[model samples]
Target: MPWILVFLFCLFCAPAQAVTIPGVTTGASASQEKAPPPEPDVEQKKAAYRALADVLENDTSRQELIEQLRKVADTPPKEQVPVITPPEVEDQKTVLENITDVGRHYGEALSSRFAQLYRNLIGSPHKAFNPQTFSNAASHFLILAASVFTLYWLLRLCAWPLYLKMGRWGRKKNREKSSWLHLPLMISAAFVIDLLLLALTLFVGQVLIETLHAGSKTIAFQQGLFLNAFALIEFFKALLRLIFCPRVPDLRPFTIQDESAKYWAVRLSILSGLIGYGLMVAVPIISNQVNVQIGALANVLIMICITVWALYLIFHNKRAITESLLHLADRSLTFFSLFIRAFALVWHWLASAYFIVLCFFSLFDPGNSLKFMMGATFRSLAIIGIAAFVSGLLSRWLSKTITLSPHVQRNYPELQKRVNGWISVSLKVARILTVCVAIMLLLNAWGLFDFWNWLHNGAGEKTVDVLIRIALILFFSAIGWTLLASLIENRLVSDVHGRPLPSARARTLLTLCRNALAVIISTITIMILLSEIGVNIAPLLAGAGALGLAISFGSQTLVKDIITGVFIQFENGMNTGDLVTIGPLTGTVERMSIRSVGVRQDTGAYHIIPWSSITTFANFVRGIGSVVANYDVDRHEDAEKAKQALRAAVEELMEMEDIRGLVIGEPSFAGIVGLTNTAFTLRVSFTTQPLKQWTVRFALDSMVKKHFDLADVRAPVQTYQLLPAPASGTPPTPEEPTL
Candidate 1:
């Protein structure tokens, strides 16, 4: 099998030199002669031709042997389309011949064209100059100039003061607050300045060209020069704005030193102007006046110089790049952040590679190279610009929608943080979608891929179906989850206003159910999506079932707790806020879970008692409770008077509003329930609502003390005394005393 695989690889993957012409080395010296080719072996040549034929016919051989070959002769590959005449069409000269005719006697042609231009310049200087045209152009230029200056002065004088005032207001309203409004104002000012400058510069060029009243060639040259110069100046302005972002150090995103920023900006600006001038201004004019070979050579050399200068500038500012990216990467130090940092480095390298490739094309295939490069460059830039604009609009719209959503802000006030987080994620998805669409459009524009063709194709149809299924699943799942959550929350809120405020147990159960439903919906959606995308989910479901069974067995205690809790709830053994005693722990029932119950004690401490550990359950606050107090009275006191005093106290306690509502019946003074050595016990009892027994008992005790004191009924007390010898006989002790 291994030998067959190797044979197959060798048969299908032939090198270019083995089956076709070897590529010519680019930029070789003119004086260097081409190397003579070696003669090919007859058998090897036959095998090579056979391989080429097999490839062209799309034929495969599973058991073909690799053949040894002699050194082969080299030649240029045949052009698929004729460079000169149309294939199989008319009899016509080649493109090279046409160009030759055009460039015939190049020096004489240039001299004659120059002579004609000079004669025109001399014979009709006044007409060429056109004083009236010059005056009109000058007037327009002056108007544009004045407008530019006025706008500039307005910004410097009025806008600056307004910006400062706004900044102060922001500070006063909320110190250290970063106002979103301020940023837009600052950005708009910079943008206006840049726009006015671009307009003024372009207008000046138009005026100069109109005043010259030059021929088409001169006009083109002037326009190209102006564009190049304007680009360089704009770049410089952008750099300056970036360095002075917010025009306030406090608001600057980056912390680079002014000196470093200024130094790099100067060097970069100089390089930008030099390269832009060479490519846009010098090259076009030189190419117009020069032969094809010289023009190509000059472009190649100039591009090389520009590429080298750009590289130098890039490497020299590596410190600045690193500093800026380090600050960005500091925002997040996760794997994605590291990836972004690495991608930044790779992006710079790719940019350098792009320039290097341009130079290579100019060197070897300069014809229409610039035109093709510009076309692709502009298309790519358009895609980027459009994606950015659309994504920004989408993000802003999403932000606004989230902010204005009554359900999001009102229904789940606690979910404010989550709403903001999801908004950010949604915006990111929107940006990603924009980028994808822009990429497809860009590819279509470049003739690289036809989106409509793909859309109509069989594979594309399948893909679309899968995507639709996924989208539907997500939409329905989200709707179901939201509806379930909202219903649960609303029910909870409604339950709060009932006789007893909504208990944590009810809320907990609803929340758990909602979460469980969400998980179930998400799982089902994922499985369906996977199936739609051609992934089998049957095995996954089987594995999950097995795993769950194994977990159940391993966690028997958990199962026991869940079962016990279910029975407890079904039997209504306890309720949230009920004063329940479970085994040794006693407190108000705070919350109930499938496996455990949370009890909050009077001391504000919580005890989480697992159901498995609860062997006894006592609930004191479930219904009415007896408030019983046993009072000991002195035996010497009249039982009737005590009884009367107790009755009076109970009556007084009943008169109080708080006790009146709590007591189910009048407090009864049951006479002489018990006898002790020191006193007789009287029982007083009353019934009150659950959890109100303590309050009633306290009030009753206070009332009894007051009524007894007023009635002169003595409370039983133990007394100790010391005497002289029992008074040694009673009589004389009165004088000796009270010893």
Candidate 2:
């Protein structure tokens, strides 16, 4: 058994020895390279294998190693261990806490910066005021100033003639026949001339700088600072002059006394110069030569002076300015003038607030504040000016009453009035819109909102679309109503050279159509507007339908009234201006609606009677009317005579010019219709045109009385006398009948 094991192990070891290790040379190959080893006999190989097997069988360590190798081969390879990193933990601070922390951080930074500024301010002179440096800077500044002054003198001398000519021209133009364009043109010319002078001065200064080879910082700073200050202040003065024209009274744009104009111009110019020079030139030069802290301190002082000066000016002129604005408002009596008056009332306070805010802003963030304020102010002014101009134009154009052609006016008189009223309303709406847009733009300019971004965004786009749709809807609705009204009015009135007068039925139907059209148009416009404005009109429509159904069920009487009125109108039972008897009330129809009719009675009472309540209706003006007169005569008198009297009265009524046209036919007499105890009754009926019954009846009755008197026909009269019933039981004397 040991030999077999050894043999098997030898076989395995042989293949292993033949397999090449990556970096090792086998002993057989090494020997071949040198001298080949002598071949051993098979018996020697067997002897060597038996010896190795005996060693392996007796060695406990070898057995253990083999067992371990076998176990290693049997086991599967281990997989790599995966690494798991924990997710990053979120910060515990909320938004408000983070903001507070940021604010605190900025506050600490600001305080530190301010402290640094204070230290720099205290030490600035020590670092900045060496004698040599001071002398050098002063010498350079004086040289630059002298050069600039020389240049300015030369430029002014050269331009003096032109400036004088422009001024004279402006004055002469003002004295000429004034037009709306003249003042603006003169002011523009003056502004242009002033600008030309400024440009020439600046050009000369630039030439001087270039000629001097202003390479040194001191020279450059002085030239840049002083020249820019001059330009700014001069430009501002030019603007003031344009407005005030202090030297020329007639050229002044505003209506102010010459003394007042000159006063304001000079003072304002001085103030602007002080503020502009102090901030633009003084502070910058100080900072360039000394330290930024001193410049900042100087800036604050200058701002303080400006604020105080502005406040003084505002308060001093507050009452006068307000009164001027009030006078303007009274004269103009327009919406813009009213706004000016309101602004005038608060202008002083507004001015004070503006300066104070500017001071505070400069104190907080001096670098950007002035730029922001100036830009915002200019933009806001431009916005307001444009809006005001547009509004004024709209008002001027739309304020006039619309005049229609003669034919239209004659046919439809109310159309012109209605159109004019609509125009007035449109003007007001346009003005309001312009004001609103101006406010929005002003807010945008002042950084209150980002209007352009909002306008480009989805919400603003949708809003604009909705507004446009609403406007269109309203416009179309107005047009529809106007057309309907015009058409209906044209139908209602008589045309001498055109169509004849509309019948009562035609007029009634047209009026109803006009009202119905108005209601429908209004309903459709409202519905479309609601839908456009992002309202879910489905629910509204559904609710309206349900409500209408409920109303139809709940108010059947209203439905009945409407239905009855419609039928009555269609059948021409009664119309406006017709004498109508509805139920127990008798009146002339004054107005009619879908559900009710407005009746004005002879007693001056207006009754709104629903059609449903009209059980009996009689229209006296429909076709023809008959007036019946009855006269009773004495029993002894002949009834034929009374009939003859009535006939004679009707004849007389027909003879009258006014009543003759009203009487339609001859009178018919019923002789002796009845006999009473005292007299016999004779009835006669007169036929007349519709609506002429009352007039004809009154005239016929008067004629009847007169004719009866002329014919000596007597009506029966019964008389009673109470004889002294003195005796207790004496029967009363019998009443006697007298003719």
| Index of the highest-lDDT prediction | 2
Q: How close is every model to the real structure, measured as TM-score? A: 0.57, 0.75
lDDT of 1 by residue, 1-739 (tens): 9998985564334332234221211222223335423435666656655644553343222112111122122233452311111112234699998888778877676677556534433452231334564354444434544553455445445545554554455444444455556544554555465556556656665565555534445444445454544555554555455455434333233466666656656766666565555555555544444333344446657878878977776777676676677667777434336645875666667667767766654544444455465567667777876776786576566556345456454545434554555566656666676777787877776567886788779776777787777767766776676667666766566332253435555666666687778788888888888888888999999999999999999999999999998788766788777898877777888778889999998899999999998888888876688887998899889989998999899889989997899888776667789987778988988989888899999998999999999999998878555554454546743433331
In model 1, what are the clashing residue pairs, if there are any?
none
For model 1, the stretches where C-alpha displacement exceeds 4 angstroms are 1-296, 316-348, 394-424, 435-468, 495-509, 602-605, 675-679, 712-739
Candidate 1 lDDT for residue 17: 23
Residue 710 of model 2 has an lDDT of 92
lDDT of 2 by residue, 1-739 (tens): 9998995665444323322211121234322444644555677566655644543555554565456446545555453212211122344799999999999998998798667656656665533546666567667666766876677667656755665566567666666856446556766776787688778878877776665534676766666777777777777787887788777655566788888888899998988787667766777777766667778788878888888888999998889888988887887747878798889888888889878877766666665666577678768878987997898888787766767898788899789998888888878888898898788899898788887887889888777777788888888889889988998898899776877888878899998998888888889888888888878999999999999999999999999999999999898888888898887889899998899999999999999999998888888987799888777888878766777787888777778898888887777777788787788888878788998778877877788889989989988878564554445678656654443
- Alpha-carbon lDDT of model 2: 0.75
| Cα deviation of 428, candidate 1, in Å | 3.1
Query: Model 1 reaches what TM-score against the true structure?
Result: 0.57
lDDT at residue 376 of model 1 (Cα atoms) = 74
